[model samples]
Target chain A: MGLLKKRKREGGEIPTASMADIAFLLLIFFLVTTTIDVDTGIGMVLPPKLEDDVEPPPIKERNVLKILVNETGQVLVEDQPSAIRLIRDEVKKHVLNEGVDPRYSEAPGKALVSIKTARQTPYDAYVGVLDEVWMAYFDMWDSEARRLGFPDYATYSAAVAEQGAENQIRDKIKAAISIAEPDKQ
Target chain B: MASSHFKKKTSVKQEIPTASLPDIIFMLLIFFMVTTVLRETTVQVRTTLPQAEALTKIDQKRLVSYIYIGPKKLDGNRLGETGVQIDDALVEDMGSVRTIMYRKLIEQPKLIVSLKVDQTSEMGIVLDVQQELREAGALRINYSSKREIPS
Candidate 1:
């Protein structure tokens, strides 16, 4: 009778000995498939489509700094042949002139940096010129941030961001960069 | 008596407690699962991005749409003509870029088009694509580039 009762009684609990193996399998699969790389790059905003009937606003010749990159990868700052290394200083002087120079901008807020590239210009060359221009603006912003009692521009911007305050530096020193279209090939 | 007590202590079996093994594995699995992106698209073009110093990171990845412009990769380590790739397909006609981008803009108005162009490629194709993007009203763009190693 005892032997029969023992045979009738089944195992009290379901098997969990294989759970660790199953979890290990899933962990291995996920570990093999994970990718942690982040995408980084330069950001820009393109102007919207212009209607045929709308006329473009006119910017003064003196306030606009013309930068041209030709097919040979040569850079021309204000129609004068220049090297890529000189663009940053030239851009800074032009933007920060504050009416001291006759050929430079009237004010930082009104200054315009126009970049025009040829159809055959290498993409890297164009990017190099653009990077210099942006670096000039960043330098100006940093000085402005320091004048306003901050260690650097990034810190000022971050502090302002945390407080939900308007960025006065950006408003005062606007980066008014315009990308001009190249002539048709 | 001391010898008997020492023998009694040595008689007990020693084994590692592994009852929490599944929980530990599950934690690791969750971590990997959260970070995984599952390798979606197979890029057909070779985008050797240009290097630059002025760079900004796009934090919101969901708002990004990629446009790859580079030489078409062919068989046996050869590169063909310059091609434009959107998603997994290569765009044959340049004019269709406007329509395709316009449709994308309709779905996500804040779509930021990330242009991944090869370093040696000319500006002609890049501008053409920009023109198409302007027409499509997807104005926000990112020029994908590597950070310049400071010399």
Candidate 2:
């Protein structure tokens, strides 16, 4: 039995524990560095939930202007197919034509513009429309401010000179031009 | 005479041990390869998205809507028997679809409506969809595209 045991002795044993540690370290390193992907889609501001059934304030008929985008990407303002370049002017005309009422003059939430676009439209087209709408909002606000004997530009320099801080005035203007349009895409 | 008879004795022996490392590594590699989840192509619409130098990463998981523009057909035949399809859908007439979207938005305020449009689709169609979203009060929107691989 002693002779057989001596014969069974061989070379040094392999280091499996060290190899396992190295492999585990490598796995953890890769896991830490790998990036997880996210999906891209539309962005929108959601309306706040109402606890009680409070009747929404009545909106003036002329204050609401509707802009439409078809599957072919043509912008129609009140059923007329208008060129993309002309949309700003058209929107301005609509806003100006609708005289400001006491409700809207004191509060900005009264004026609302509805914009509707088709699902088949491209992203560039949608962005263009949004840019025009935003421009229209600013233009209308500036026009109203100028008529009210305020400065034409609503920048910080002008606001600081006229009022203590422009932030309150800016908020007032933004509140006046509430975007009521909902995106369907 | 006794001293001449006593010569030194010698023993000869050899042994071999099995190397199990390579076998174990090979099996582990095969197991991981089989179990690893492969990245799948996400969007269903077939489109060649426009390239951008800088793109913001998006994280929100929401339902994405897709639109395809190809040759228009009447009764399974191209309009006017012509192979070319013209984009004719108008933006103002999308009230029905808008109502549906409004309902969706009311249900999940965080939902993002993605537009996957074909490269060949006219710019007019794309614009129409965007306008509709804006009208629906959707403020957050993002476009989908594949990251370009450097050659």
Candidate 3:
């Protein structure tokens, strides 16, 4: 009877002392191997393919801020040789001109920043110029947001998103950037 | 008297209650298991992305498709001519990109093409690829770049 009782007690419980160790081992393996880096980048929308016979809309020369990047990574703004660093300020001034400067745009809505690159232009150089243009617009939006009693544009945009409202700032001061095709190689 | 008191204290049965330890570990293990992505595509080219300030995070990974453009990685640390890779294969003919991307767009109409171009590549190939994308009607593209650290 005593032997039978010992067998019953032994079979009643399985050893769980090492379960924590086993779990910790698997957890450590996964923890060390897991990668959760988020992908980030500059987003853009390309123009749709145009029909051959269709005529493209024409914009006045004065309203366009033409930026050109050549094979050697040199930059030109409005037909003037310029550095990449100055492109941001030029973009801002052109966009916020309000018709005060005849050389710039007639109005914020009419302002179009056109980027043209050579076929041999380095990818990084193009990205650099594009980055500057985007930064200029971002700065403009920030000031606009501040004027409207918000901390910054991001917060204001977030609030607008929450209420499912249109982004007035973006609509008012649109980022009318155009990426012109490179000359045929 | 002090030695006897120390001996009596040491003789008392003392054990840490570890019943919940396994449960805690299992919870953590499950979390890691769920969040881990086991299968990732092996990249063929050496695409060191450019750095920029104005960056937007792509929240949904499902809506994005990657296109890598860089110098082809040859055997023994040698790099060949610039090549464009979509999925696993290097696109031999530039015209075929339109068909491949069009098929992808059919599958996911909201497809966002993430262009992971190497910093050293020229604009010629990039434009060619972009034209093909335009033909495919996949106009939404993202230039995959790292955030520039402010000086």
* Top candidate (lDDT): 3
User: What iRMS does model 2 reach?
Assistant: 8.0
lDDT of 3 by residue, B14-66 (tens): 99988999999999999999877665677788899999999999877878889
Residue pairs clashing, model 1: none
Off by over 4 Å in 2: A1-42, A46-57, A89-108, A117-127, A134-185, B1-41, B47-151
Q: Rank by lDDT, highest first.
A: 3, 1, 2
What DockQ would you assign to candidate 2? Answer: 0.12
lDDT for each residue of candidate 1 in A87-125, tens digit (9 for 90 to 100): 999999999999999999999999999999998899999
Q: Cα RMSD (Å) per model?
A: 3.4, 15.4, 3.3
What are the interface RMSDs of all the models? Answer: 1.4, 8.0, 1.7
Tens-place lDDT per residue, model 2, B1-151, is 6555554222335455435654565566555544443443332233455432223345434344333333333454333211111122312354544665567778888656655444445544454455556666654555554443546
What does the lDDT read for residue B41 in candidate 3? 74
Q: For residue A166, give model 3's deviation from the true position in Å.
A: 1.3
Candidate 2: lDDT over CA atoms?
0.50
lDDT of each: 0.92, 0.50, 0.94
What's the CA error at residue A86 for candidate 2, in Å? 3.0
